[model samples]
Target chain A: MRPGISKILAACAAWGDKTAFLDCSGASLSFAQLHELSLRLGTAFRHMLKGATGRPIAVVADRSVRCIPVLLGAALSGSFYVPLDGSLPEARRRAMLAAIQPELVVGLAEGTSEAGFRYISVDELYGTLPDADELPPVDGDMPLYGIFTSGSTGFSKLVLKSYAALMSFIKAYIETFGFSERDVLGSQIPFSFDASTKDLYTPLACGASTLIIDKGYFAQPGRLAELLRDQRVTSIVWVPSALSMLSRFGVLGHISLPDLKRVLFVGEQMPVRQLNIWREALPDALFANLYGVSENAGNCLYHVVEKSYGEDERIPLGKPFPGTQVLLLDEAGAIIPPDQPDLQGELCIGGEILALSYYNDPEATASKFVPGPPGVGRIYHTGDLARYDEAGDLVFCSRRDHQIKLHGYRIELGDIECAALACPGVDAACCLFDPGKKKLTLCYAGASGEAALRTHLKGALPAYMAPGSLVRLEKMPLNANGKTDRVALARRYCGGGDVP
Target chain B: MIESNAMKEQIISILQDILPGEDVTESTTLADDGRIDSLAVVELVTEFSIAFDVEIPFSDLVNENFNSAEAMEAMILRLQQGT
Candidate 1:
């Protein structure tokens, strides 16, 4: 059996009264406060929920101390939480709400009400009282939380994670990275994404402090630099885009972060051109590349930048974390020989840290998560391509499918095509991604122009999902299979043809 | 000194190059209108820095400075005078 998340939070509270979290505005919560607040909120949730467990509770995850308790309260109430970004487009937000079908929507403060769903404020949850301080019994196998990731099916996929998976990965992460109460973490990613889980939970698990940097700081790298220096943030686990933005703006050259020790980046490939800029600025800081999918609880592989890489060299994906097994298999499901460094195969992850499943989508769950050969049990078949390097380190090659990562958000080309197809006057649509330019282009055989299609896409998709360019095609190229020839479309649109 | 109207026209030309087919006017709110995202902003910074021979500091990257073509021209003029 595994220990529940409630027990972990209680233990962290008992550890010490160190600061657990602080938002960009300097508002904070101590460990004791976090525990106390969560308990109070959880008591209210227990009263509201009664005996119902594992029910998805949607939380408006704004950068407030109250949201932390709201999330914890869901866990304490024997229910899992799903954090929704307050800034999401209405259509997209409605799509997620429709998918989750949440019974309760937790808001940060009072006067929070949506049309259909019952809305309850986190503050109200804290204010209201239940007779007892006790929480409902919880099992470690129970779902702890669910986070939405990009789905090839156009709709966002809610990946449900269990308490066991989270705790196991947290333990591995903390142990591998040598994090303790002495360290101060600077938050980067928003609470809506899985990357933010590391920032939010690390403090609770390690009894350390977390400084939540403001989202606006990203736009102004100088302000971000100021926060880094002001907070004395020792470690920051961020996405490559965030780090790259700072390097691109040349902010690292202007500022100094003396206390910063560990610089961890994940989500997308770190451009060597930008990584070198960071290395030159913070020579002493240990830069590391982490690789994982939201389908897995967190990161599975990590590589410390021990040596200098050339400006164009692709960094190695590195070895698996403790207890995690990474396998590379060819299209025929046969294991690729490790010694053959040149042989590329799809990356497969097998471990306890794997997510329970995509919430309420067993079809998708079955499609990706399959039983491994004999003893390996269940393994998540990642569509990411990989190859072993000369040093036996796992190196990333290219994506096996049309799935792409732009600005650290995973996107599927199929999803874009689906959105484009849904638009009126659209007959055929193909989305092509230019990796080097980080630009998305659309080639469509349609009556709708760029503006019309863009307007339709704005309603259907998020800002990042919107195509940078749209071109009209008299007819779509088809392969021998009679399917839309995406490669030919990409070559025509992304390579040279500027068919406006 | 180049006339302010000419500078504004040049700025509009640059905006047109960065964001094709968008209505970029003097009163247009670039950020609110969703014309200048992070990627476009980066390109704008590079373009504006080179076009105006002025370094666009990250501090000056706020919405007020880049919300309109007129705003961008004013900023360029101010930076040109080393103010």
Candidate 2:
């Protein structure tokens, strides 16, 4: 059996009547209750799969009490789970579901079904029991879950995580952070993203209680503050945008969350201005900046915010966890010496925390997960550019590709350009990222109105992935090689100028 | 306050510029029609705050106020008058 799920099962036995998960409406599932329901549901899954292999079970992972047990049940059935975003556009969600081609879709209701997949409602899964005597066996190396991330090539990619990789990271995380049963976690991220894995599994690993917050609360900062204050939520792992929203809305000045202790932000750079607002309000809380990718099983490095920072200054990635190795490689693939500290390199993560592989995409997997030079485990070549700062902290510089992180969501410039080209009356388009302004711009040479292109792009992409600004030019500038001159576009259209 | 029609036209122009292809009108449902998402909402708030010279606090950010350009115009007028 996989050690992580077993650890969770043991927590269920130990915690007994204590609440394991709670939703926004005060609906909850106790540890014992979750364990019992999941095992029975898992048995039903095993029977449904009939010992099928390599087919993932997709769950519409909404922020509700029902989703937790279904995810756990998928693991118990000796199958991995892929969490689909309930809030995404149907076209986008359909594209993701089609990419996975799941064996079964465990949805909230019965009417939801994709072609060639068996559909089972959460209620139906809960009601049925397997005829088998025991649950299916789980191997540690088997995939635990698959998450969808933005692909530079216009489509989404499925990143598969193994039971061993995630569980090992969880153990290392718990040991490094000193998490325990006394903590109450308020989860901020949706389960569809790998970032939510920390919130989903940490409670079980440390015998803690998790308050699964409502996504709607984010739109209302006052309500979110009240939930944190009332729930006495001691710890929270959130994206910088969430924290910045709360800070920008002055949520801290209106309410005081005395019980809040640990504040962790990941997925994007936490602007020091927003960090200062949070730090000034909650002086006692431990603030940490976490850095990692979905392929690295959550964060491999974290930096405890020890000193004050300027508003525009970039925060360091700090240090890696005990079991992880963060190495930098130069342009020629040579290891940049740690002592030099001046050379920039692609951030390569070396550790067991690396994911198993991209699901069914060996070519893409081989390009990233390469063998380490001498006696080291395989390293994940993160396309992120980085360099060690004077303080010896790993600081992020820029992306080697056109990949950009806005509001903690990854977006590829080419992805936006592809969606833009699909719009009627659009011919040529180029996407640019302005790091100074921290905004995305799309310049196109198309007859379609800017509003038309925005609407078309919105239908194809999520809100975060959409360009913040659009520019129309009579003709897109091109280089001698006939490629769109992206640098010239960035130089001209990057000052938040009027769209023309 | 600025002329009601002029303000509405300006708001439509802003929406058209930001959104690109929507048939935004005085009564178009911005939020319901998915023309204005969360990120777009932020852009709208910033544009309104700058153009109207009024602070559009998050508390005032509701679908009712932003569902239509007319609602946004009324909101701007109210905030402008209060100031």
Candidate 3:
């Protein structure tokens, strides 16, 4: 099959005059403009690389239209893009940069960037040359993009995905969903998140346009509803948490989103309570629960909410996409037969969905990516636990580890604790998430006051990773082995109170 | 409306109770600074409605009104005076 960038090339040929992207600020990029800019940036990268290719190019992913072209351009020139959230703590971004050691660093559209990395701009990319006659030949095996996710050790983990894997998933997703030139996808997911790729590339594959909804509009559900209606948005593939927030804000009934047809969600489990609200509001809309990770392009499992269920019932994780295989491996690494209904096993993903490896992390790559049972290919051991329901769909169970998914972000509790311990005057720390309250409460025993720790956390972790509220104690409760007693701490402070 | 300082003090006291361990200054940027989320906004609005006996409508829940204590108080005053 063709390489990942070829999809854009084909789109440029088919729908050059069509609007490919429309930013919330009323800025629009036609397919022709996107193609021309991508070519220019590719030529610029060629000049920068001189002869080098297959290098990592870091792009500070501030909310801007320039970011899309910059990413595709990097691939056009035979290099991969690493999209970073500009709002991340400098120290955290620095750690991520250190891991990738990107060939070039950039902030394409007034993108917020830090020092120590020689940065470039989109204008400079356009200035490279008038035009490049041809792009470098690329293979499906070539790295497409490497994305960083939260790590248990406080260091971000860069998961590198190949163009082949991305291409396969995108093709399957678009074909299955039947996205077309008539569809206007409302983009909400951040570029840093793997799922954002679905919103970015669906247009290229099917000649649709994506409305770059303002990130700030998420907190203001009324504005979000207004924008979706104004833009005539037909589809939305976003994290369930953001959808939950809008549902919680009660904006659906007030605003009419007649054109919004598809509501696809991934990242975390969509709360049935929140799902019901959306379902009730948009009675005719197709609501689907997508399941996958950064290891894949976006998702492999797609479950359409065709049937109604109680607010307490779960929406299944559904069957795999075309050409993808899913397995339930028991403790002995044997595949749990499909007929074994009530037994839970660790979910293993295989086929074209597997990523190349974790960038700069050999042990992590080795431990998670392993050979599958018998005819199945090498699989990625998703730390998530799953069970087969009577409907024959995979039902998600709890995670095997302490990693918790909050507001569509997968956070390792230890990462927060590690960052807290590094702060001045912090003796011991424990972070917990009350899913019901949707709050991250960090409890720390330290000489530093609440405000000081808050500042430190703000500068160290992303806003989602940072605890919304803090609980300070003179000393931490200890367990038998002299470890921080998380149970005692949870019992005292995290009992569903305001502090909790 | 009651005296400005007394009303502001009452708001601050309620905010502190809702968002403990946070330094709620007079000029604190609530929504803009990302200090307050939808949940916090809901809680604060509930408390303000109980204390001030004024219903803060959803339309008044924009960032400008919820940005600071003064902004919050101004909105409360408008709602109290039936503006």
TM-scores of the candidates are: 0.80, 0.80, 0.80
lDDT of 1 by residue, A1-500 (tens): 66787788888987656789888766889898888888887788878877688899999887666678789878888889999887665667777888788978887767857667888876667576633346777899989999887543234688998988877888889999999999999887767777788887888888888887766666667777888898899999987767866787678888888999999998766767678888889999999999998788878999999888864367889989898888999888888867889788899999888899998889989998999966787999888888899888899866666778999997867667767766756656788888878899988864567889889899888899899999976456654222466666766778733211
**Tens digit per residue, CA lDDT, model 2, B1-83:** 67878888888887887777676785457765555654456556666765677887766766667788888888899999989
Greater-DockQ candidate between 2 and 3: 2
lDDT of 1 at A338: 74
Task: Name model 2 segments beyond 4 Å from true.
Answer: A1-4, A130-133, A402-500, B12-38, B62-74
DockQ in order: 0.21, 0.21, 0.18
Q: Give the best candidate by DockQ.
A: 1
Tens digit of lDDT per residue, candidate 3, span A78-123?
A: 8888998766657777877887888888785545455767688777
Q: What residue pairs clash in candidate 2, if any at all?
A: A450-B20, A451-B19, A451-B20, A451-B21, A452-B20, A452-B21
lDDT of 3 at A410: 71
Q: Provide chain B TM-scores across all predictions.
A: 0.87, 0.87, 0.87
